[model samples]
Target chain A: MSKTVLSTRGLRKTYGKRDSKFDALRGIAIDIHQGESVAIIGKSGSGKSTLMHLLALLDKPSRGEITLHNHPTANLKARQLNTIRNKEFGFVFQSFFMNSNDTVLNNVILPLKIAGVGYRERRRRAISALKTVGLDDKRNNKANDLSGGQKQRVCIARAIVNDPKIIFADEPTGNLDSATGEKIIDLLFRLNQEKGITLIIVTHDHELAAKCSRQINIKDGRIVADSANETLEAENDDKEEFKDNDMDDMLDHQHPTHHINVDEEEE
Target chain B: MRMLDVIYDANANLLRNKLRSFLTILAIFIGSFSIISTSAIQAGVNDFIDSQVDSYGGEGYLAVVSNDSFDALDGLQNGMGNNKTPIEYNPDKIQTGMSPLTNEQIEKIKKIDGIDGDSLAKEQTLDITYVTSEETDKKYLIAAEALPPGNVKVSLVTGKQLNLQADEYQILLEEKYVNALGYDNDNIIDKKVQLAVKDDYTHKIKTFAAKVVGVIAPSVVSMGYQYTNNKLADDIYQENIKYYPEDMKNKTYAVAVNYDYENYSADEIKDKLEEIGLSAMTVEDIIGTIKSFFDIILTVFRIFGYIALLAAAIGIINTLFMAVQERTREIGLDKALGMSSKRVFLSFSLEAIMLGFWGSVFGIILSVIIGNIANAVFHAPGGFLESFPTFHLVVYTMSDIISVTILIIIIAFLAGTLPARRAARKNPIDALRYE
Candidate 1:
């Protein structure tokens, strides 16, 4: 049984006053388990991005509690939160938010450098991350010199360079063409499958949302729906059953060893 | 990752604005240069005066004259004064109202434990002649003094000094007179010269012949107002004479004494002379007059230097303020990266100090060149305030340079601090958004 990676309860955010107030997020409750790939789907101004920002520790909720990897976040100082963001979580944005002045390699290495990783090790990990995104050849190119798809790939490389446990991507491929967007989604899925990293993405693309194992919908600062994808529901259940069977087999093999240890101690 | 790294990064950011940094540094240099050059020149002058005074035999000598001598002689001629006798031209005439000290009186003074030897002399104006060549003769009687050989010290550069006990006719010439005579040592020494001394009572020119025994360099004592009163007369006389035993003893006028310890100070010597019934003046009085003149000139130079330095400081302040405004966003970025306000302030202040340090270096180099050129052109004797060619105005001692460097750096730090603090205390969000 994997632990829950993130949990938020009674989160509320309001802008302005009572009469002229706008509630960006209203009492949103959510839980995300480790290794889960989830998408948050909503229309423009649907509060999905605000929820993602709060979860990413980029913004503070007006009234709520948030816990990441079982660590309470409400009382953490700004520096401490920045440390957590550098160490435990990675972020990708719709605009690809790459530092225009830095080369692609430097951009990728920034998160690890911020985490105080030694230079050589940071470079190695950055190169590996760039290879994973299929942009290893573009390492020396400036981020601003890259096309929309290539820029998003560089952003992905930066996000995963520190090997964070979770990646929060907001409209990760929204600025790319449809084909390039699909390719980015496939690459993200591959990384999640192979590395067991949790992926929390917010997007308006229904096709991208349909591909995820779990989908959450938000509207008017409230969660409208949360359910497993109909197409992947049966396959997910089968994989869960197979994981349970493998655990049983391993436990059965260790039973005789446990009994032997007990007899030896008694003697 | 480290504090040094943070500073280095900030320095790189500052390097982007090279012109501003250069201008700031120039301002600091000018300020430091002004202070250092002024102090150096003052030190040089003081050193020169100290040397000159020491050579004139430690400050115990004093000049004494009658109290009425300070009054103009016109009052005595009007018959409206206390004593209605015509003022005699004899040196002894000024000796009235003054304590008369004989050889016995000086012996008593010498026995007073702290008292040293004293020299007494009398002076009179006379006409004299010297032959520069067999055919060319120059005549102009000069003011000449009769001094005791043992008591008076002469620095003779050429020829033999006069023998005190010998009944021979000999005269010593000042180096200036030697030059004026246009006769070198070979020609002047053993040369015969006649002096025409005017007898005050007889009102007749009494001619006496003497041999040039020694030529002395002009000492500060010998150049005092009492000795060479007339520049033209000095050239005409061309010498000082030693009277023989058969001649009448020269009437005494001024007495100069050198105290050993109890009253070796200039002021103490003057007081002692006054107590002994003679009004005395110290060498400091003459030096003081000279110093006041030097002070006026130095003050003018200092005023000009300060004006330039003030303009430079204003330039520094303006440049620093502009830097703060331009780097508002960068400062916010550093804060966002978790740098403390103090660290930010330190970076800017250090930059300002560097500016001052470099500016001072440049200004000092410039001042040295200029001071040297001035020294070469001006040929005045070095005193407590006057710098001459042989003496440098800007003495670049290790301690002096180090002190000036530290002072400039400190000043730069202060100048930069206001802008630095303002930048550091600014709201991070506002700074970040500042265009």
Candidate 2:
């Protein structure tokens, strides 16, 4: 019953000339509802990363339309896109594109800073986000000084620092070993389950796609399959149950006997 | 981020390239130093000239002379009289063809609207003697001027001034003359000395005795015994009463007129004197000849200072260019981070201005230190840097300092603009990709 959080129709990105042109994204259409963990899987140059960039507003689509939280992004100015990027969406890159000179805490707080959040409030939110990723103790470590797994965790922490509506992660664990990559995947799922944030991840690993509630497989810049996994669906139901219980408890504490009477009078 | 953060970042970045920054600053410093030091020296020189001029009476005074021949009654003619007779003159009667200016001429000049005061004086070349114990006689030809005791151009070390109204019984001696006589006595105000006067008609050398009532020291002693002997003397003597005659009044010459500009200019005064059949000149004419000599010397010094400044400007340009090259990456990063082209330009220009300001400050301090050291070594006085033996070190006034500061800033800003614009126009993508 919740609103659809993201939708795209005939999205296309073409690079180069007509004679030797390349389609990074060719007529992609998808809709993501609230609180969904969707994984996009493809081989190298399959346009998974291009689609992620379009979804994140980091790049403009050469053709077609994208609507996020019901706001059309196709005709948005660069500054408006930047504001949307800052306020509505967060990104985690596989290369861990954090400023090398900044510490883990500073990197995590950067999005908030660009959003013009107050310093103390930014620090508090960044620390909370780092705690969610279990990297609170490593806040002072430089991005380059951390191991592959820790750097990815820092990136995850930075993505969730602003409590954005959606997180678009590109090859989130492509560089890490199996064990570290698994830990990163678990962290992403935990943020999704606990915060109810919409998670859209691009990955090459089929196992990672199977772990999400929905999987969209791309081949040559075109989505070939969109399927829901039974196990992921069951886990999502359990998460919905916990959320409903928490909401009931919150309503009880804040507004008991929540019933409204409508008064209708003829004038 | 706060502006302070931006400034601090800039300062830190500049500090990382210490040697380059220092060189840039030095260039600015040298340029400002040249300008300030030269101005200070010029100011000191002007002050010296003004003092010298004031000491030689005042700026408004003019000394007038006559072009016509002299006659007997002409010499004694007081300008206050109404006798407008133009005497037919003989050139031979005129002493050296420089016809003596009469008291009448002085009074006539004084009657002019602008004329404030005037003095008529007569100078004669005569042999004077002092009898040491009546046997040892010291003989010297002295140029003696008969001025009103108050009108003498020399200061007296001792003794009373000669009474000009008292015929020739009194005389004022030069300080050197008194010292040379070895009079040894402290009070020689009433001492008698003899002066030889050649009679105009008889052509006989008559010795006349007069009392030494005063002593005088000329500011400049030319054609005096001191000029030859390099020793001071008291030689000025009053004429004796016995030899003084009515006919000798034709010897009068030299009139100095003091005037104010409220009524007439120097040219007007000169013209008025010419109307009365006398020639005249102004003090400015004499000063102009003297200043022309000094102008050449100052011009040479100023040219040298200017050359030094040109070299410093070249150094500044070089430093700024180097800085632009070094900060290319940083400029690109700023542009990528949403910095406007104008802001980037302002930042770079501000950095240049800061460099210039610091350079000028350091250069001025260095110049002052060096000037003072030179002054201490050479006993220089009264200039900003005090480098001369008689002038102090050249100190800049507040206005001078402000002007130099603004000039350095302007130069720095101008120097930075070209490089900044070049950096700003760079494509953001290309700049970000630069290693």
Candidate 3:
């Protein structure tokens, strides 16, 4: 019953021309609610990554439409999309793309820096994010010198530095050993439960999928199963579920009541 | 992203590959060094020539001679004319030396429409047998001539100009003469000097006392010749020609005059003189060849500098292209994190500009150091430029330095556009996938 944060209807993505044509995402439809930890589960080449890219607004869909907070993104300017990405959403990549030569603090400050935040404020926020990942002591360490697990932790710190409403983590722990991967998962779930931040994770590991509040299975670019289908159907019975007040609250940059509203919705 | 951040990152990125950036900047340094050095040399040469022009009877001043005299001199230069073999000697045309301007022709010249008649002064060749200052007993052999009329600006070391019409005899001593005459430039002013003219027939010498008005700086136009005012020149000329026959006494070889230069060009005045069977040569005509010679050499050197700059521009393009390729993944990550395509392009372009800035700054520093050293070396004792105290071998003007830096920066930006565009147009997904 939480407010929908991201929604798509019959989304599709294609690559190349007719002669060498290929469909990366044939069709995908889903509604992601605020504060809900959802996992997109699929094997290799199953288009789960493409679906995440579309939802993250990193790429344009070849067909259908996507809406953020009930507002279609088809007419959004590139500058607006960049602002939304920089201020409203965070990302954690599988390989941990970082400026390896830079300090850990600088790497974590990337999103806020992109948002043109002031030097002092961005630095303070970055330090706080590093503390969340328990790497505050290693802020000055070069990213390249960190261990794989530590690098992943630094990347998570970078992802949450901008205080995004949602964090889209693509295989957040794929490169880590089980022992370290377990710690990373626990940290992500802690952020979800404590901050009530919506989490959309793309992964193929069944164990990781099972930990999420709901799992959506994908095969050949199509959704094969969804654990929250019944809830979606029940919400479909009320067409006006996305109220104007909810849209206004979601659009506000300083929306501070999401956790309280999500807790009430959960109860 | 903020422009300041973009600029800072550009410099930081360049530091990531230090060797590559240094080598690229070195190439640009060569181009900028050569260009600025050539500009300095050109400026120095031009300054020297301008000073020389001012000394040689400045604008509107002309040296007038008879057409026959000019033709005779021209024939001598052209190997005594087209007649390969002597055929017949024509008595009417046979001339022993320069043909003197007739008294009738001189009167016509003074009456010319644009010519300033009051500025006309007969060129008196004063044959001073010897000159001796009151402080020195040694008499040095000397050649003195009357100062030409019309805007004659003689560059002086220390003293005043000659009073052309003053009844008392006055002379301007050359810099070399000041010390030889036992007097320095500052103390030589208004000092008495003795000029002796020998009468060839009787072997009798008459000494005339003249006051030194100024000491002349060493100049190409003057060439060690002492300048005397009209009174001193006429007295010496009359004393030397005291033994000459009556008919040859008044013969004038040349006369200097000033025309209306603001209203009429030199060529226009020359044409007017030509109609009256007279020939005139302006300051430009006398010193133009030397200027053209220097201009040709400097122009060739300037062309070489530009060619080097073109090669350096290519180096910038190549360096940026390689950087773009190497930072593909970084670019993708930045783009995925919502850095705009424009910001990415700006960052790379700023890198190229930074390279140019550093390269040109280094070039200017090194060139200025070397230029000053060369100037000092050339001016030291035993050097060829030792006599020219005022001439600098290389002159660096602020305008030239600024213009060169700006031009190089623009070129660097243009060269960077190729690689920056490629980086900006890259798809985040493909760039991230690129190994």
Candidate 4:
């Protein structure tokens, strides 16, 4: 009976036109309930990341409707959408995007600043958030000076500084070693369990997906598995789901050959 | 966020790239420095010119010169006013008319509109001699001005301005002439002096006793000439030309037209006279011409400053554009955190303004210091332009400094716009996707 905090109906996203048209997301219909932990499992070229981006209001959907908190977001102004993003949602990226020039505390205060929080109040809250991530001692350290594990922790601190109801993490531990990756995952799971915040992760690890309450497997812009009713052990034992989430299962890769380098967006 | 926070953030951004920001500011400093220095030079030069003009007796009085014909009389009139004019001296050229202004011509000028008084002008005569108070020994034989000395600017050293129109025979001795005539520093008021006149045109020799009213100070016009009213002059004129009725107006040399100044613009009067093939100009007009020439020089120097500013503006644009490129991910992160495009744009623009503000302030401050140093070195102190010497070689008025600062800031804004717009319009999703 829990209300859906965010949902998409027949969503589609395409790039380019004519002979070069490429579909990144195709007809995805899903509902995300409040306080739910969901993992979007996919191969490298699956549309899971694009779908996550659309759900987080960071990108416009090409078709169908995105309902956010019972409101249709199709006609929302960018400012209104930004307000929703600032107030209700947080994002954690695989690369740990942060202002390397800024101090650890200042990096964590970004969300509060965007929300127009006062200086002293935001600083206090940023300190508290850093403490939550066990990084209070490194508050004065420059972001670039921090270890990869610490940087991810700072990103986590920033993601939770505003006490957002939902945190959308795209491959949050993709760049980390297994031990540091497990720590980050444990921290995310703790935030979900203790704070009752919804967690939607775009990832390819079956073990990571098994930890979530629901697992949605995608391939080539279409859903191949929905594990809402499946048990955790059943998901772990499923050979087909394991193969579907494999990095090498992308023979009909929807992404371009050069798409592996996300850094090209700089030019 | 609060506006202060946004501004604070912009300041922090500048600090992050200290060397780049400093280099950008140097451009603005160069521009504003040139502006201040050029203005100071103009101020100093104009001050010197003003004082010289004052000493010339150029205030309110117009110069009438002969143009090119046989007008030796206007030429003579101009020759007398040479000491007062701000115009560069060219003794060979006469500007008005070459023909001697006859009595008829004088009468014709008096009829023109705005001629305000009965004593329009006085024609000077060279045929005169100043003797001692005894009226016996010829003391100083000088080109004496015989007529009511109307419209001539004078300052009294010890006494008041002499009443040139009084019926009594009164004279104001020139201060230099007082020493030459063997008088001490004692006040010359009420002292009786003798004038001997020998008019060649009228064929008469006369001597008259006149009361010396006051001693005149050195004037911009001249310190050599002695002054006397027409009371004694009229008596001498009547005695000499009583029987020579052959149109005795031939000796008329110059005419001074007095008009109520408020009734017509100075240009109107000058233009009106030019229509009749004559030239008329006030001391103010000559000063204006000189100031305008200085203004042209100042403007050229200012253009050099503008070039420096232009270079600075380009530097700002280039810096901000690079910042936009370098901070791509940061900008995306900011946008993702709910920064409105307008706020993003404002922050970038504010950053540019801060750069401009710092540069202009430093430039102005440096220029003022340099100007003061130059003033100390180059000021022809005490009496630069005697009438109105600009006190220093350079002047930094509050208004000038403020205006230049504002101008630099505006230019910085113009330079910042393109980069600001680019940052503001960036797509968060794509920007976040940037590595």
Name the runs in model 4 displaced over 4 angstroms: A229-267, B43-61, B64-97, B102-119, B122-263, B380-389
**What stretches of model 3 exceed 4 Å from their correct place?**
A230-267, B54-60, B64-117, B134-137, B199-204, B239-254, B259-285
TM-score of 4: 0.75
| lDDT order of candidates, top first | 3, 4, 1, 2
Write down the C-alpha DockQ for each prediction.
Answer: 0.08, 0.07, 0.52, 0.62
lDDT of each: 0.64, 0.63, 0.85, 0.75
Candidate 3 backbone overlaps, count: 0
Writing each residue's lDDT as its tens digit, candidate 3 over B1-435 gives 777888888899999999999998998898889889988988887788777777665788899988887656444544555766654445677334688998998999889888999898888777889999778989898888988887787888888888988999999988778889999877889989888888878878899999999988888777678999889998888888898899888888899999998998999989989998899998777767877888888888888878888888899999999999999998888888888899889888999999998888898889999999999999999877898887887999999999999999998999999999999988888898798
Question: How do all the candidates rank in terms of TM-score, highest first?
Answer: 3, 4, 1, 2
Q: Which residue ranges in model 1 land beyond 4 Å of their true spot?
A: A1-267, B1-11, B29-33, B54-178, B183-285, B288-325, B376-388, B397-400, B425-435
Which residue runs does candidate 2 get wrong by more than 4 Å?
A1-267, B26-29, B32-346, B380-390, B422-435
Best by DockQ: 4
lDDT of 1 by residue, B160-265 (tens): 6565444555677765555566677667887755656543344445555556677765444445221222232333333222332322333334555555544455
**Candidate 4 on A1-267: residue-level lDDT in tens?**
688999776566777765797878756667789889999999887889899989998887666577888898888988898898998998899999988988999899989988899889999999998988999999999999998999999999999999999999999989998899999999999999999889999998777788999889887877677876332223223343344335323623443222222111120
lDDT score at residue B266, model 4, on the 0-100 scale: 64
lDDT for residue B71 in candidate 2, whole number 0-100: 33
Q: Could you give candidate 3's per-residue lDDT for residues A109-221 as a string of tens digits?
A: 99888888989999999999999999999999999999999999999899899888999999998999988998999989999998888999999878889999999988777
- lDDT string, candidate 2, B1-435, tens digits: 334434554465457678978876776676677766766655555554454344344456666667574333455553335667745456666533456666677677678777665343333333343232232366655555444212323345566555556645565666656655656337566776655655444555556556776665443222232210001111222223224566554455566566675567778877887788776665446556555665666566656655655565566567656766766654543443334566556666667777777877876777667756655655534633332223343545667667777877787777777776776576533453366
